[model samples]
Target: MALVDVDLALIGYGGATSLLLDALDRHGVRGLRIATVDPVETARPHRTWAFWTGPRDAFDPILDAAWSHVDLYGPGGAQRLELAPMRYAMVRSGPVFARADEAADRLGVQAVRASAAALDDDGTSVTVRDAGGAAIVRAAWALDSRPTAPHRPGRTFWLQHFRGWWVRADRDVFDPSSAILMDFRTPQPAHGVSFGYVLPTGPRTGLIEYTEFSPARLDDAGYETALRSYLKLLDLPELAVEEVEDGAIPMTDAPFARRPSPRVVRLGTAGGATRPSTGYTFSAMRRQAEGIAAALAAGGDPVPPAAYPRRHLWMDAVALRAWDRGLVAAPAFFERLFTRNPPGRVLRFLDGLTSPAEEVALMGSTPLLPMARAAAGDLLARIVR
Candidate 1:
């Protein structure tokens, strides 16, 4: 088998690899030999990644939409939260793929169109064997960003599944200045909860989605019924369905390994970027990519650091435990948080950027006693394990 050597090997180029290449390109890391391995010819899936961040992006050319404020509806009532420093933005995969390709080409990123059959890290270097049993890439460091599935069930697990419809109406039916972060006005599941969110690309059109954080997923008919009912509740004009988007993200407190071996580091969801309480991965994934790329460009160790701090992960574990045990109701829990906390605090907390003082105040907005008990139980379970 022919062996090709590189300075760094990216086992998958779907999302994280693309961003890493983009960051490396922007850094102008000269003469850094990189190989990206993925069997797919194009990773341009019709997906939308939403994240709350500052107003600037290196990929602003492809941004689908951005909102300065968001609306929240819960059992108590409806409220609007203004986002001053941070804006919620959506980016389409097609544009991201295109932009990343441009950057990869400019940075001289070698593309390897092969499925990874095996990875061997021998402490000194890492080797990647393709599905055809060829040792295609050997490098001092490797970033394995292969897409992961939901396995290793945690004590608390939920499927954050959703179906979105991109529709356009004859008249202006959407508000471009703001988006609906969460609308708990939708029907609730017996075991979990249901909500809806709208991202307005324009005043007359946008994508509306019905989402649930439940242990089980709905059948085709069930999802259709729920989404149709939600649309009816909004009382919107008859619109032309332009496209459909759907996917499911696993929200679990299970530990994800960042490094499978000494020289091989994981990235994206495999590296524990997804938040357990809120199925948000884009911001974390981007953050990790930038950090790793920056370190590499500066001639530092490129092994990924923990996506979220230990304290934050512990808090997430406790929150997930409370959610699974029904100690804190999802709808009411979020409602109280948004209503009690100042604007942008909850969003920052979700982004894992909240300070300790902000977190303490945010915790006060919940059922403190019950949450504390849940935290204690989680801690005890971990200790026993």
Candidate 2:
């Protein structure tokens, strides 16, 4: 068969790729054939992603639901706060993916179920291949989001792998209006951070997750044990498990080759959209997709924005260092922050919504000794290298 040609070739169909396709339609970036290739069977089952947003944004239409109040539980107590002028939103992966898929079809983009096997880079054009052989895709630009092996280049890159159980109780046991932000009563790892996350879908339905920010992932037994212990502590024995969701998100500084070539780029977590500290990527991926589409529409560069700014990177470095040194208590630090700071400001900080001054003050809240050392060390490393 003859080779195919397109204006843009997207190599993955995950959140980032889907968002890109949607952006293309929204921005009216036309006159280009696009091909999105992915190994469909590899997509994991549905998982829930929760985020806090201000007003209407690019993805407001797709949000499955929203909550006005979020509750934080720690050693101190429970602090319930309304996310003023903002709402906490949750969207299921299945629906999000389906919506994007339908939008892509409406935009007249070809969707392929095969994966990209290889790439041939020339100065002007980019070529992508599949398992059939060196099948060519002549395109002005090609983007890829296939997973890559972990890179530990003189630094540690941890993952926040978690397994969550969607459970329903015989009686009303959960507070439908409140989403449990974190429960610090859980055991913290010696070298990393660990905590429990609960999002209530209804009075009897919620998802309880066993989360860890460690260099490796937990075994099935480990996750189940932690979740069981948490539930037992909460005295919820009558709850029955209705569904299970699990995922591993990479948190690292391994310089992702975002701009691989003149006509080639990367997007999504594969392009380092995942936060180095929190392992959240959904909203960042949305912003990235919009940027790329806007740039392409105006005959501009299509490289997605670096999800983490310099200040945000520094904040991550400082926090990770403090956690690494065992200087800060996992639950206590978060508890204090949530108790002291307004929910909106704190949520914005977590969502990468703050000025440099605010970011500095946020970092200053950490234990002075360890955080100071980390900041100084980070500066020195930058100077030396």
Candidate 3:
């Protein structure tokens, strides 16, 4: 049997790998052969990726929309925040995946339509196989961006589950200039919290989602019922559903190894790109892709940097514990954070780009006693185990 040789073999053609391809193109690193493996021909599904950043971002070319202001509604009432010098941007996955696929084709990267049944790496090369046959890809390195296996039980785990509908109305009912970041008027869960998110693309059309942060996920029927109830609450006459998008994102502090072997590295959610506190991963994955590309171009090891700063991880641990224990009300905690700190600072903190002073100020906005107790309990549990 003949073996296939390339500079890199990507295990999945998802967001993380796509971003890596984009970075490689940007760096003008061409002529390196590559192979991508994925079972699906199209991207996972129609979905929207939203993140906060300034006007200049690496993904500006594929941005679907951007909002300069965001609204937060809670028990304290509606607070409209102006995120000047920063924008809340939304990018649809279709465009991003298509662009990446085009770039791969242009660069002469081979797309292998098969599931990777097995992977064997020996510090110099990685050989992957499928039931149909086997192919030994000799390369300096390989990247596996496949979705990670389920988290082990008894590890602090939560899910940011959501179902959204792209809706259109007969009359103008949405303001396209701003987004409704969180509307806590929805029914709250006994264990966690629920909110409604609105991203208006036009005066009469937008994507409205019912999102929940909880230990368990809801069935499709459950999400549909919630969405219907929310639409009734809005009382928008002549509303029509254009499309639907739903997904479950893991929110856990469970450790995910980035470098599973000396020559093979993990990417995307498999590499801890998803933040434990907030289910935000696009920006983190982009940063990881950039780092990986730069390292490979420099003839250095392409090990991804830590998914997040140590301090940020500690904060996430305490917050997750406190929320799971119901020590503090999730809606009120978030409302207070947005109410006390400036929106830009909060966005930066969520993006893991906050300074020491900003972090301290942000911490001061939370329920101190509950967080302290949660931190202490977590520490004691770690010591005992």
Highest TM-score scorer: 1
> Could you tell me every candidate's TM-score relative to the true structure?
0.96, 0.92, 0.95
Error of 3 at 384 (Å): 2.0
Prediction 3 global C-alpha lDDT: 0.85
lDDT over C-alpha atoms for residue 353 of model 2: 73
Score candidate 2 by lDDT: 0.76
| lDDT per residue as tens, model 2, 1-385 | 3577887888877767777888888888877788887768555457788777776656677765667877767778877878868888787877777767777777778766666888777968788887777675677788887776533352446787888999988888877777777777788777787778778878778888888888898889999899998888787867789999888997765566666677778787767677777888887888788888889889886777777686786777666656666666657777766666667777878778787777666666656786777777766766886
Q: Would you list the C-alpha lDDT of every candidate in the order shown?
A: 0.85, 0.76, 0.85
lDDT string for model 1 (32-79, tens) is: 888887888854567889998787877677799988889999998889
Between candidates 1 and 2, the lDDT winner: 1
Task: Tell me the TM-score of model 3.
Answer: 0.95
Residue 270, candidate 2: alpha-carbon lDDT:
69
TM-score of 1: 0.96
Better candidate by TM-score, 2 or 3? 3
